[model samples]
Target: MMAISVTQHAHLLASRALGWLHTHRERGALPPGCTAELAEPDTVYKPLGETGLAASLVLREAVAGSTELRLARELLDFGWKQLGGGSMLHERLLRYPMMSDPLETYAHYARCGYRHEPLELLLRHTTSLHSTRAAEVLPNRRLAVANAARISGFDRGEDGDEGPRTGSTGGTDWAGLTAATWLGALPEPWLIDWLTAYSMTHTVFHITDWGRLPERLPDDIVRHVGRWLPVWIDIWAEIGEWDLVAELLIVDNCLPEPLGDAAVWERLAGIQHEDGLMPRDGHPVTGDDQERFAAHHHSTVVAAVAGTLAVSRTLGTR
Candidate 1:
């Protein structure tokens, strides 16, 4: 293998990671006749959405090279098709109007120019209902809905500069919803367990629209994250929790002024398989095709997101 600077390491990491996702896109497929009414959406639907989320961010940042870009678009297509071309989302909303996953999943595709008119209309109407707001959900899930809603024209954006990304009007206060999240509180640092760490990273992800708008983050929140995120990154990296490490790395690049830790980036690149898989931990990744995909697909998506943001932020700074 050729030598690489840390920035180049990030570039290659992104392309390779996304390449793996495109090749294994089928691994995330739902079973035949799957529907929104299914009891466990996580087994397949959630993975598809997460994959789309990574691919959409790659397109949105316009940071990936031509190969990565093509793969990203293909990944989006696969996700949309897997959802029965948005019919699943519409049916999902019909089944459980209060559910946010469909809207959240649809927004990932919409931001990248994938559209489903029926889903959009229903999302607009359903999200506006008083019950949607009244739905008892975790605060971070609420933030996810707010971000997705804004992206899909169901609500206005955080900047308030533009109306909805589409034609819809009136929505949640992005600022208020964010404040309700765990990270928004900036509570005692020692209180952050592994789960809270994931929550904090996601809060960063949703608030910044996966790093497209770092300016949307408040100064206090930024400072709070900046002050403590390094410690968390170091702790996770030490434990071989490569999945969480990659997420914290993405959070780093999302900051108004990123740490741009070259050592960590290089370390991540070194550990990634030649085919672009990033193991979830230091253990050898093993399984049948399906088991491996199920076990560590998330870490790989996170690695892709991390590397993509790292490159984009560096170029943006320059």
Candidate 2:
């Protein structure tokens, strides 16, 4: 299919995914794996903390842009109510000390225009994580904290070092973060597992603002990711891991010079179901409605976001 057709197909899938999510909600059906036996409060936190699936679905709504404004608003409303007025992150942090997923998820809501005291306070809390949390956290988490800080207008000083001066006197520890992450010293791109590869993609996208702020990334790091991305994309696509494949597509668009592989785009478009339910992998979901939605939700959402981001970037450039 042509580029415009590809864009249209993505929107169609996004619409279907949103419709499916809402239809399930109207029936009082919890997402798959969400247990109804949990007590009142557990009901909210359980789904929130489970496997990152719900949060991914919530983000897909934000990424849908103006096309799903009404649905997006409804989803965000449900999210706030479910998370106990959005203090779940704060509560989780008080308990877990140095978790990274909460920070990332909180940042997603913040990015979606849901700014409030809870999120703002968490962004401030990230400052402490730089020292106490940085050593133990992965490279992707470090980038995540920085991105959250930037988005929330929380500066980590001009040096970008929350701790003492560890790197060169003036600049942020760009070099240090790269050295810490998988992408910085890209191993055999074909050999890394899917999750690790996806994490690398996240690191690159967040650190470089999805390639819009390419200068923030080191020249060698940028070249390194761009060089091996096609191989990684092809391998994952052939395996029919649509979630990771869609993520790789986002990564492709985020490269300074995007790969923009028409054939790969075609493959992704071909796999999307008529109702926009992109299977998480080669295997199909085999369960009840809620179970099936839970299994397939993350990949379907990823496909929507990947398509939206690619189309938006394409439109911006044109």
Candidate 3:
């Protein structure tokens, strides 16, 4: 197995990671007593949202076999059901129209043609507001919302500072917002911290439309990411920060010319459990299934995305 091609390794890793997610899909369900009031991003929505994002990316890449594709589609269905077929997002928007998570999460489902007309209607109006455009989120987060708005067909334009703000988004100022993100400035690589590294990765992800358009990243930004990304991945991977490492790898995959580093994928593959669950860090998972799910769910999604995108980059080019 060690001698197998890197592309094969990525596919296997993706298949198993998704298998783990499907087996534990219910672990991602809203807690029995959980209500909208009690639900935080991590508690209910983030897990499924990330899962849907992974599923949607896998489907978009079109590199998976029938079984893997089936799992991805099924996972999308489960995520939508968990969100009440978009009602939960609709209600959340009603409560906090400025909050971007609902619309961002909704975009994952929307990518694959999942729609709740009422939710769409609500999203259309809420996202169009100038207030929503200037919602003061972290810049990368603004990109997330902008990309989501674009997906939902509510974006006025992917504009930037080339044209003045006019104090109205007229849609999203993608270029100006990109300039606002941590990655956009192409900051000194040494300045990044753990959390900011994530902000940077997500900036690239949203700008590239989550690997659909690697060329969307500016040439300088792409060169900066391509140069430093390996070091970042190694830094985290060395400390057993498997989740962060996987995300950084996804950033690599989003490059116009992904490294598709065979050694890295092999090392990552070794981290997967026999059942497909990838641990979040060097620490052993030492809790009940729900505890394990909570601890490692996001990494599992990241691993699935990383592997799927890796395969797409490696094999698609062949």
Best by TM-score: 1
All models: lDDT? Answer: 0.84, 0.61, 0.82
Residue 53 of model 1: what lDDT?
A: 88
Off by over 4 Å in 3: 1-4, 159-171
For candidate 1, lDDT tens digit of each residue in 1-318? 121355788997888899999889988988887867878888768899989989998988887778889999999998899888899988988889888888999999898888888887787678767778768988887888877876776775435645643433454687788888888887998788999999999898888878877888999999999999889988988988999999999888878888877888888898999888889998988979889899889999998999988888887741
Better of 1 and 2 by lDDT: 1
By lDDT, rank the candidates, best first. Answer: 1, 3, 2
lDDT tens digits, residue span 90-203, model 2: 665556555554555555556556666865665465554445344566788777666655544553444443433222123345567667888777567667886798788888
Which of 2 and 3 is ahead in TM-score?
A: 3
Q: Which clashing pairs does model 2 show?
A: none
Candidate 3 lDDT over residue span 1-318, tens digit each: 332477877888899999899889988887776544535677776888889998998888888899989999999999888788888888888888778888888888898999989887777677667677767779988888878877766666653322222233464556788999888888999888999998998998888877877878899998998889888888888899998988888898788988767788888899888899988899988899899998988889999998888888777641
Query: TM-score for every candidate vs. truth?
Result: 0.93, 0.77, 0.92
The prediction achieving the highest lDDT against the true structure is 1
Count of clashing residue pairs in every prediction: 0, 0, 1
